[model samples]
Target: MNIEANNTVNPEVKVGGQTLRWERQTIEKLLLANVREQRAARRWRMFKTLLWMALLAALVWALVAQPTLPKTPHSTGIGAGHTAMVSIKGVIADDGESSAEYILPALRSALEDSDSKALILLINSPGGSPVQAGLINDEIRRLRQKHDKPIYAVVEETCASAAYYIASAADQIYVDKASIVGSIGVLMDGFGFVDTLDKLGVERRLMTAGANKGFLDPFSPQTEEQRQFAQVMLDQIHQQFISVVKQGRGERLKETPEMFSGLFWTGEQSLQLGLADAYGSVDSVARDVVKAENLVDYSTEENIAERLAKRFGAAVGAGAVNALRSLPPLR
Candidate 1:
């Protein structure tokens, strides 16, 4: 007997009960989706990395690179002869516009320039830090001797205290008739908040390892010993300042009783007292005294953007240091 075996085939014969065509298609779609997701993730990572790098580079450039300032067309108007000019205006504090840090470089450049006939410091300041003034004074003396170039100080509105201190180092100090000059002295000033704290019923708690760590704390009551020590220190600094003035001015100073008593005088009176050599303006000094009518400004001024950037960078660095520090603070 010839018998034919029954033939049967299930529709869902592939793995996971799917047809071969459907299984292959599903696998292809999954692979494509995975590839697309991987590509997008890679692109996002690359973008983020590049963005961070760009930000870091910008920050570095801002902090490290010197900010360029636009030179005015009239800045280089030293017509036939070269008369290098550096300005010392405002407070002469270590960090101020009239600080030695800014003035010294300009002075060096002016002195080093063979084309420069002379150097002039245009002064219009009420004075500030004696330390800064002393530094500039020393440098001016050295540069003058080295370069064999005469440096003159031409006072504008005022040149008192530290301003006068620096000007004393110049070969000659010229001033306007009404210019305020002198004030050869030193002072350490501060405010005491102990009474204010007592009125407010606020108690200050301070801890320190060193004995004199809270030496000049405003919240704490000062002892007689502390007061004496402070006075002694001030006296020493005052003597140092007096010595410098004497050394710089020599016999030119009239040696008045109030000269070193923090007393200021007019430019005309300064000439009589030998504090100033003559009465002249910048133009007059450059033309008549220096014999070079042309004036070339070498003064460096920081723009607002540069100042802000520097302050921001300094603040960021200080904040980082302060965050890591756990030392006792002075009140």
Candidate 2:
């Protein structure tokens, strides 16, 4: 007696007119096939799940650990606590890495950071353009007044001229005893090769509609009038720099009238001149005063790709400039 699982007829056997049918066995075979399919499906699902988990872990590690390309080796201060240090490098030019665009953002981050108790400006510039230096100084004032966070300027190997202008805005300026400081002045040095060109039978043929169109061309000799004019421009810039420093340092600056004559000073002489607030390195100030535990450098880390792009762009720009200069005079 055989009965199918779906419709059992409680009979010993179900037979057709010409053949007998094994219904129970057929039903068992169908059930076994379904069980095998389900088992294979479960194994496949487990394999897919394991693969997904491994891929996810690899992705997580890549995201959380943003790696940096190796750069010039230098020791940075590492404390036990969590405070960020914003470091400044190179000349403070309107263009290039030292521009206000790069500097002000770092300063703003440091000032607005809730985790940082105070901010440090690590300076190692020989100075650059007056405009760039002034822009930084203004931003520093605004940040200080807004955030009320103590800002310290730590001068490294050297901090002169425009660098000093920016540093003066710090709540207190710290310098290594051996650091080069001062140079509170402005200068635009250049060479005129017109006499040498005449000796070599070369001509500097220049024509301009404006009287002072080529005011300070390096290939042309300057008349006394032009020299006086250049000096006046330089003097004006120097005066502006002096005023900014005085405003930032207040009575802390004890400089003689000759300080703005474009002279450089050692870090030791700087303290007495009121150019710097103290003579100490970053570690001394951070550990002794701010009490920061860990120091994190917020400066942008340059990668190989970024540097290569910069070089390529610079080369293209230089080529364009040379091409334009080589063009014949417009008739």
Residue-level lDDT tens digits of model 2 in 155-234 = 99989988998888888999877889888887888878888998999988998788777868888767788889989998
Q: Which candidate gets the maximum TM-score versus the true structure?
A: 1
- Candidate 2's C-alpha runs over 4 A off are 1-81, 314-331
Clash counts for the predictions, in order: 0, 5
lDDT of 1 by residue, 1-331 (tens): 3323333352233454433554567789999999999999999999999997876677667646655332334334345477889999999987777888788878887777666788999999998988899899999999999989899999999998889889988889998889999887778877789999999999989898987788788888888888899899888888888887788778998887888898888888998888999988889888998898878787877655567667778989999899879677768
Provide TM-scores for the models: 0.73, 0.70
Give me candidate 1's TM-score against the actual structure. 0.73
Q: Candidate 1, after superposition: displacement of residue 259 in Å?
A: 1.2
